[model samples]
Target: MITQVQVKGLMFDPYNNAYIVILRDDEQSEMLPIWVGKSEASSISLALENVAPPRPMTHDFMKSYLDAFDAKVISVVITDLNENTYFAKIHLTYVDSEYTVDARPSDAIALALRSHAPIFASESVIRKQSSEELDQWLENLKPEDFGKLDS
Candidate 1:
């Protein structure tokens, strides 16, 4: 089982780097935050804000490539989590065949936004890997708090 989710926002963790929170679309109260590299965070931020760059970024190039090949990104799936890392896959369809490729959840999400693809979290991953305390903390967080980060 997979639950649909939406990008909640990009956040900065003062002690760490930046992270983007995703929330269950059906149950807005359920959420997860994945820490991402600065570059990836920027990419995700640009997309989330609908900022069109002068040229195509890596993910934008991917969207063009998919379009050129008549392939559509069906959805992105948050597949698993191990140790402290989370994993994801991008599902694509072309002609009569479908394919899935491994991707960082953040990049997958960036592409999903460009392609208008939905996002999903595998039930197993959520059941076993999600942190309730962290979720609660994020839920209570305000955007102003993210601006206080030294980064």
Candidate 2:
């Protein structure tokens, strides 16, 4: 079983090149945070803020590929977490054929946002990785905390 989840927030850890991304369950009862690379973080942030850069970013290019082929993203699934690593897949329907491709959760999410696709997590992964409740103070987090994440 899979549960639908949505991007809740993006947090930055300045000490490392790591950016933390939060995912909220459909019921808003849980949050799953995953560490991602700086560039990926910036990409997700751009979509969330609806910021259009002067040029297309990598994820934007991916959306263009989808548009050109008439392929639509059905959903993105965060499927596994092992030894501090996360795994994900993008589900697409192209010309009546369905395809699932391996992707990092951050990249999957960035593309999902571009495609208006719903995000999901495998029930087992959610049960293993999500916090019972989201951090109450996350709303106060500022983009400045993200540092030079676009790099």
Candidate 3:
């Protein structure tokens, strides 16, 4: 089963020069982090910041192209995990036809935000990550606890 989630924030993970996309599922109160590349991270961050690029980026072009074709993104699902790699698919609807397109988690998420589509992850993926309840984790962390940590 796939559980809907929202982007919590972007965090830098120095080990692989990757950006971690943090996702939260309110109903389950769990969090999942997926590592993404710097370019993809920049796209996500730009959208989050509401910073429009001088020219349309790849995601922007995609959104426009889909809109022009009357295709609407229904949702994005992080559907599988293999050897630590995650896979995703974007579900789209055009007229009465529904289609699924394979995509990287990063690109799927970036497009989802642009298309105002819901995000989801497989339950197994969440379990694999061992993500604890958000409230429980937050309860154990004080603001000052993070303030002193070196980023």
Candidate 4:
């Protein structure tokens, strides 16, 4: 089973040289972190800050393209964790056909937020990582948490 979540915040992971996507569920008081690339982090930050890009970024273009086809991103599922890697799928619905696309958790999450789609994580992944780890990681972050990524 997959549990729906929300992006609680974004933080840098010095060990991985990448960003961490934080997902939270207040009802259950749980949190999960998935490491993501710099580019994907930038895309998510831009959307969170409501920054208007001079040109449509890849994710924006994707949203527009999907909209044109009347396709809606239903949800994003972080389905697996293997050898320290996280996997995800974007569930899309278009007319009569439902499409599932394999994607990195980072990219899937950024697009999901833009498309107003709920984020999900497989029970296995959550069990492997544990919410306590997330709590500790979040507690250690400071105000100057995520610095700007170099373009």
Best by lDDT: 2
Q: Which candidate, 2 or 3, would have the higher TM-score against the true structure?
A: 2
Tell me the lDDT of model 4 at 75: 92
Cα lDDT tens digits for candidate 3, 49-124: 8789998888999999999989999999998877657889999999999999999898999999988899999998
TM-score of every candidate relative to the true structure:
0.82, 0.85, 0.83, 0.83
Alpha-carbon RMSD, candidate 2: 5.3
* Local accuracy by lDDT, each model: 0.78, 0.84, 0.82, 0.81
- lDDT, candidate 2, equals 0.84
Instruction: Give lDDT: candidate 4, residue 145.
Output: 52
**Which model is ahead, 2 or 3, in terms of lDDT?**
2
Position 34, candidate 4: lDDT: 73
Q: Looking at candidate 1, what is the lDDT of residue 38?
A: 78
Per-residue C-alpha lDDT of model 1 across residues 1-151, encoded as one tens digit per residue? 9989888887666545566555455677566667676777777888889999998888898888989989999999989876657789999999999999999887888899888889998887777645687756667866565553321
> In model 1, how large is the Cα lDDT of residue 9?
84
Candidate 4, 1-151: lDDT as tens digits: 8888888889887745788778876566677777677888889988878787899788998899999989999999989987667889999999999999999888788889898898998888888778887677567865455333221
- For model 3 the local lDDT of residue 40 reads 87
Error of 4 at 144 (Å): 24
Q: Which pairs in model 2 have colliding backbones?
A: none
TM-score of 4: 0.83
Candidate 2 weakest ten by summed lDDT: 132-141
How much lDDT does candidate 4 score? 0.81
